[model samples]
Each structure stands twice: as structure tokens, then as C-alpha cells.
Target: MYSPLVQPAVSGASSGSRESTRDNVLNSVLTHGPVSAATIGDQLQLTAAAVRRHLDSLEKDGLVEVKSVAGSRGAGRPSRRYVVTQQGQSHLGDDYLDLASEAVRLLQEISGDEAIRSLARKHFASLEQRFSELVPEDADLTDRIRALTRTLDEAGFAASTRRAGRGGKVTTLRAAQICQGHCPIQEMAGEFPEFCEEETELFARLLEVDVRRLSTLPTGGHVCTTHVPLGRRAHASLMAHTAQRAEK
Candidate 1:
């Protein structure tokens, strides 16, 4: 039963299987993050101990992070939700960003800044079409913003929405901000700037309300932040949106 070659082969296979399971755990965290460990275990059909083991490895490696929230069962213990860190996203990998940035730079040199602006505009127009279709025509600003956030998440932007406020509490101001933890084209956008401008403009056009970029990932902010006014001039914005659609 103890053949040298066969024993090493079995050991290697076991190690490979463990690595595969770890990758699955990491992906589950990314897709359903700010999610609890139990939930991930259930989704992956892994035991609690197994999931925790993988998560501990990921956390130790700086690929996963945890947030403690008040547990519903009682206040004595808090539930931990896991989300991938920026480094974790890098682990997921974005190949050729450097090459893409060089391509955009070349385009700018050949065609000028307006050409880059036009390219950016055209680029986001498709995303606008895809994201807008996910929201209802009469949805309120909260629902609308959340829909956009959902779309962004599905697009791998790692986006989340939060009510914009000063201090730690929700602001009285009627505005919310969309925070994207990861941007696929961050490297390229940093050089051109047109991509960010066009994306902000796209949000305004889709929401039919003026929006602002408070900060951006390329600008050295932790996340890309966009300020969206909530429930202001809804009717006017709707009318403007309708008019724009008609003209197009």
C-alpha cells in the first residue's frame, strides 16, 4: 500500500484540491460580500470549520477583511461580514491594464483630448443603456440608486451605496453617494481623466439630475465616489429624461 510514487501523487492531489476549494471560497466572498461566514458556508456547501479555515488564510494574506456588526440573536456577540480588500481584487487579477492605458495615451496623442472625451462618452453610453434598463421608470431616487449599484456590482465594480452625511450619521441632505471599491479601468482613467468625466456625465444623464464627483480612485481616494441628489426635482428630471429620449 506504500508505493513512493503513488504516495506523492496522492499528496499532491490533496493539496491541489485544497487550493481549488480556497479559490472558491475567495470568489464566494467577492460575489456576496459584506456577507457573513455562515452564509458563505451554506452557499459553498462547506462546513463552518472549513470555511473559517479558508477565510483565516485569506485574511492573514490580506485578501479578505471582516466587519463586525451587531448580531440579531443577542448583543453579546457580533456577526462578522467578510469583504475582499483591494489587494484581494488584485489577486482576482486585471491583466493588460498597462497595455490599455498605453493604447489610450496613443489615441490622445494622435486624436487630441476631445477624441478621448468622445471615446469615453461612447464607452459609457453602452453601460448607461444596460444599467438604466434595470430600473423602473417611476422608481424613487433610493431605488434608482440601488439599482445602479446592483448593476455596478454585477459589472465587477464592487460598488455599494451609502447615504452621504457628515460625521458618522446619515445626512439630512437629500443625497446619497455611490462608492466603487474597484474599477477595471482605473489605470487608464487616471491618465486621460475623460473617462471619469464621461462616467459622471452618464450618471447625470441617466438619473436626469446633476451629479458631482466628490473623489475618485485615480485621484488617490480609497474609492470612486459620486454624489447623487435624492428626490430633488424628480418631475423636472423625469420630463428632461423623457425629452432627451424623444430627441434620440
Candidate 2:
């Protein structure tokens, strides 16, 4: 007899703990899939059985689906893989997705693309203003970048910053890269790339420096990357200050 896997709800078990585990499993699939239950278990340090139980729940909830991969040799059974469904992807962020998309489409139909672009710019400007307040006027570029990354992460972008080049008397150019691991409005942004453009412009204004977007998630890049030049003049001035301090 085939029996469905039953997860017992323990009276002593904390709902918060169970919810956290479920979220971790979902996030693992969201970030690193189409993957196998075994892979998810290894990444998340959950037992294989536990991972499958969570996967089953996710599948039942319409958040994940199983895919079959061909066996290495023709004789064996195909391997089962798991991938997030469209509904699953949407569940990861932006609850008002349909409404937001519809609103953008209606705005475009009513007022044209420029109106949509204007709205995007205006929307992102609020983010800029909020982030600007968090970073002090005297904060250096790195401090500003860190502050912006923190804000993005809190807003569910999973953003991080990294420095690329050496900054010294010998090196005149340096750059910082901001990588957003996820975008809440990736689907909407695909249809309205103005969202991305407006975001890039907003970033430049907030940083008070020129920045270039290298890639975006909507266009199939793994992450959204922005390149920010620390400026040769700023580097030269810092080097000069260092030399003056050494002379003193």
C-alpha cells in the first residue's frame, strides 16, 4: 500500500520555528534551482527526508514542480529535479504583482510610455530620497554604497557591494560593484524596462557620482550589477593627502 508522507504537528513545536524552516526551504529553491532534493538538503543542512517533505508541501501549494532529467546511461530511471513555478516565483516577492502590472499597462494605454517612464522615475525618486537621508552628507563613497546596499537588502533585493581595484598612488582608477541578487519586480521590469533605467538614474543621484549598469535580472542576467567609478581625481586627492601626512 502506498501511503502519503505525513508530517505530525507537535503541540510543543513552535509555529515560528516551523515557518522559518519552510521559508528557508523555499528560499533555497528560489535561489538555487532547478535543483534536486539532495542538493537542497546539502545546501540547507536539512535531512533528505525532511527536504522532500518540505518539497512535497511546496509542490502541493503550487509553488514547486518536479522535472525529470535524463539518466547518464539509457538504462536507468530519469532523475527528478525541482524547479519553482511562476506562481512560486511571484510568491517570493511583490504580492500585488498582477495589480502592479495592470496598473502599468493601463497607465501606458491612457497616457503613453512617457507617462509610464515618468511614473517609474517618480516612484524610484522616493527610494532615493529615503536612502539619501540614511547616508550622511560627509559620508565617503564606500559608506554611501554600504548604506544603499543595506537599504536594498532590507527591501528584499539581497544586495551586496564589492571593491574591484586597488587605490593607491600607483593606481589612478578604482571601482565599486553593487550586485542585487534578486529583484522584486523582475517580471514587470521585463515588460517596462523604464523601471530599470529609472532605478539606475536614481542610484547615480543618490551616490552623487556617475554609475553604469552592467546587467539586469529581467534580461536573464543572474544578478543586477552596477559599476561605480571612484574617480581618478578623488584617488589623486587621497594619495596627495597620504603623502602630506607622511611628510608631517
Candidate 3:
């Protein structure tokens, strides 16, 4: 049973199997990202240790990233979720990126910049409305912001939220940072930044508090970060949007 030829064959087969399993794990993260290691193990029928091993390799290879998702109750530790990165997307065979970029260029040439802006606004309108329904009207800024990131995660943004800035001191600030680990329209957004701007506007309108873009995936950033000021009530923003809608 310990023959030399058989040893090579067995080693080759074991290596191939490992590679296959690793690929499967990466695909799962890409498809359902902002997903947890436990979820990945359940989906792929792999052991916890096995999933962690694959994830470590993927992270080392720049193929995946870990994001921290806040707990709903805000009482427990944040969960670590995995998302595929730009480099990972390439390995997944993103063949249409060039085509998408080309189409945006053509649109810009034919329709002008306002058209792109209008398209961007239209694109995020549904998201604004959806978030309105997803979060409670009485929810505070913190709750609404958390809901927003979760919605973005489901929409392929691979999003997460974390509290930032210094608190509990004189003249210090407490803010929330919404980080998007992936962007489905990274190429298109690069050509027409209206997409990103519109998203910011949407966040402002939905959260009723000011939001700022810290970085973006299109601008060579590994992740897109939006800076949101905290300690504001959602009702303030809600009333303003309501009045604006009535005028429309």
C-alpha cells in the first residue's frame, strides 16, 4: 500500500481536493458576503476549523476581507463577516467590467452629465424608500444607520458599521463610520461619480443627519467609508424629508 507511485497519486488527489474546497469557500463569500464564518461552514458543510483555514489563506492572498457587523441589540461583540475584494473579483472572472465602463462613457457622451446625475438619483430612490420601510420611524440615528448598512450589505455593497471618534470628554465627538467592503458597480461609478454622490445624498436624507464620504472603491480605496455624525434624532431628518416631499 506504500508504493512510491501510489504515494504521488494520493498526494496529488489530496491537494486537488483542498484547492477545490478553498475555491468553493471563496465563491460563497462572494455570493453572500458580509457573511460569517459559521454561516460559511454551514453552507459549505465544512468544519469550523476547515473554514477558518480557507479564510485565512484567502485573506493572505488578498482575495477576501473581514468586516465587523454590529449586533442588533448593541450589547454583544460584533460579528466578523467576510467579503471578496477587488482582487478576488478578478479571480471570479469579471469579464464585463470593461464593457460596463465603455457603456458609461458612451452614455456620458450622448446624454450629458445631468442625465447621469438623474440616473444616479433614480437608482438610489428605491433604496431610500426601502430603508424608510425597513427601519422604524421612531428609530434613532444609530439604529437607522445600522439598518442602512445591513441594507447595503444585502444589495451587494458588503457593508458594516462601527462607532468612531472620541466620546465622553469635553469638546470630543462620537460618530459612526459605515464601511462598504465591495461595490458591485465599481467601474461604472468611477466614470460617473454621481452614483457615489447620490448614495451619499440618500444616506443624508434617510438618516436625517449629515454624511460624508471618506473614501471610495473607485478612487483606489480598498473600502468605501462614509462618516456619519451621531447623537442626532431621526425625527429631525424625517420631518425635513416629509416637507420636501409635500412640496414635490
lDDT of 1 by residue, 74-188 (tens): 7688889887776876777679988878888898899999788878877766677777788878887666677777777667776766665443343336677777766778778
lDDT per residue for candidate 3 within 132-237, as digits (tens), equals 7789888887678778877786676656676677776632288878877667778788878889987887788777776789988788765688888777544666
Task: Please give the ranking of all candidate structures by TM-score, highest first, separated by commas.
Answer: 3, 1, 2
Predict model 2's lDDT versus the native.
Answer: 0.71
Q: If scored against the real structure, what TM-score would every candidate get?
A: 0.63, 0.61, 0.65
For residues 63-145, what per-residue lDDT tens digits would candidate 2 score against the true structure? 88888878758668889878667677677777787799999999999999988878887666556666877888898876778
- lDDT at position 111, candidate 1: 90
List ranges where model 2 is wrong by over 4 Å: 1-19, 25-88, 165-173, 232-248
Model 2, position 8: C-alpha lDDT score: 17
Q: What TM-score would you give candidate 3 relative to the actual structure?
A: 0.65
Better of 2 and 3 by TM-score: 3
Better of 1 and 3 by TM-score: 3
Best by TM-score: 3
Candidate 1, residue 118: lDDT? 78
